[model samples]
Target: MTHIYNDPRGFKEDMIEGFVRAHRDRVRRVPNASAVMSSRAPVKGKVALIIGGGSGHYPAFCGLVGEGLADAAVIGDIFTSPSAEQVYRCTKAVEGGAGVVYSFGNYSGDVMHFGLAEMRCESEGIDVRTVLVTDDVASAPPEQREDRRGIAGDLYVFKVAGASAHRGDPLDEVERLARKANDHTRTVGVAFGGCTLPGKSEPLFRVDPGRMEFGLGIHGEPGVSTSELLPAPELARLLVGKLLEEAPPDADGTVALMLNGLGSTKYEELFVLYRYVSELVERAGLRIHHPLVGEYVTSLDMAGCSLTFLWLDEELRELHDAPARTPAMIWEVKR
Candidate 1:
């Protein structure tokens, strides 16, 4: 299904080169490293926010590098973790003398690799901290929240960290706010089809014609369960209801929500789904702030979608509304 590539081994490299060429005004390739940094990075006294993960999820680990977002994003092979050396090189290139905060999904490989980089950076007197995103509710039960996988919810966690750091917050404060954002976020997804890796002939997995895989992962892993596909309204209820059940203890009815498409889903279809989602939220007496309906985090070409909710308090709301300009997302105040 993956049709465009000269060689499988060089896919990531080629993609990076093209990305840097296209976004040169806002970002630049990290010298001798598989990473990209904001053009205005190393902001003298600002805490640097570094976010990354495997390739294939566009607008995520790379497209997010810009003003009011991540200072840098390290890239890796498809569905693979970036090397520790790559992370260290990116840190050295972007740290502005304040500190560094590394944030990414909570996967075994990511945790191990990023941890190694963190230790190395700290040894050289760089105050580097990390915040793992664990927001996929279907990956773990409430009693084992720490074991959940990170999915589309990466957006909220990264946004909070970037905004906090952009405002010149100390490393401690940035880390705290990032963690708080992760704690308040939850996501659940389903897959109607699977994605094929570059240079591969077959998809990673397949879904039945009339059924959907619930709680699917972003890395082509199958879902936890499967059921017959329902109409858009029913699907919306299924998603919104699941999130409301796991609302944080202190949730006060206000939330930031995102309905993210995996890939191959039509934009018009997403709007139809949101019509029902918005109604469901109001019916549950929750106020939706800044509802986003589009692909944010994706599993390359997978036909599916996920819904995320960030239970917001005063602080989270302010940061969520902060001005940001990136390749995939842009928010600015109206004059």
Candidate 2:
């Protein structure tokens, strides 16, 4: 299918220009790149949290940049990794004396490029740590869990890491908290229909009428299975069942649930799915601290959703509830 923006190479540049122009006060365009450092820089003693990836994942990499999320987000073309230089510049732009924490989904290209950027920061006397998020259960078996791809769970890590930084946690502690969040989280997604790239007139993948792709990735990748579309309640049961089996919620455990729309899904549909997910969790005798239902992360205009559950202890719960003011997320401070 032909896309409107046939020039994929210019995708990042075009997006950055438009994004900064529309949200000038909230975002500052990093010079000569698709990176944008948050206008509300963390205090000098607070650690900085940086996340970046290709541009198609809207709020995932860029929209999450604000007071409560990432301090800086580097952008790349559609489903492409940002250059090491882009990552380095963003790191330099947002780093405070305390240090910087780099968090992103577990993609080989992202890991290699961001890894190089970390080394660059180290060489320049800037402290930095990396946390790779591998929360997608469909990508790997339990024994090879670390090989799983990172998906919406990255948002949970960002929330935890951002709150840690806000509390003036040391760089090491911040990184530790982010890693802990990653370890405690798991996600699974299903797509009703694939998204068409910006310029493309056709979608990358097509779902048979009334069918859904289960365990699909954000980039229109193949799923574990495709089956007839189920009602919201039944679909929720399937998704929640998979997550619970993988990481069962403790009877008294406080959990943070994210019912994220890939892009094209409507809010009403998400709430419907949330309704069932909430019921299932409560049925399992688990407490959901904050049930987030929206498009916290996305995959272009894909018509699907993902569910992420983060089992939280006292410390993680407090951190997760901490006030954050980002374009995409805002909440009360947890005192």
TM-score of each: 0.98, 0.94
Q: Which candidate has the highest TM-score of all? A: 1
Clashing pairs in 2: 2-200, 2-201, 3-199, 3-200, 3-201, 4-199, 5-199, 323-333
Candidate 2 has its poorest 10 consecutive residues by lDDT at 1-10
For candidate 1, write residues 258-318 as lDDT tens digits. Answer: 9999988768888999999999999999998888899899889999999999999989888
Note each model's CA RMSD in angstroms: 1.1, 2.1
Per-model C-alpha lDDT, please? Answer: 0.93, 0.85
Candidate 2: stretches off by over 4 Å? 1-9, 248-252, 333-335
* Whole-model lDDT, model 2: 0.85
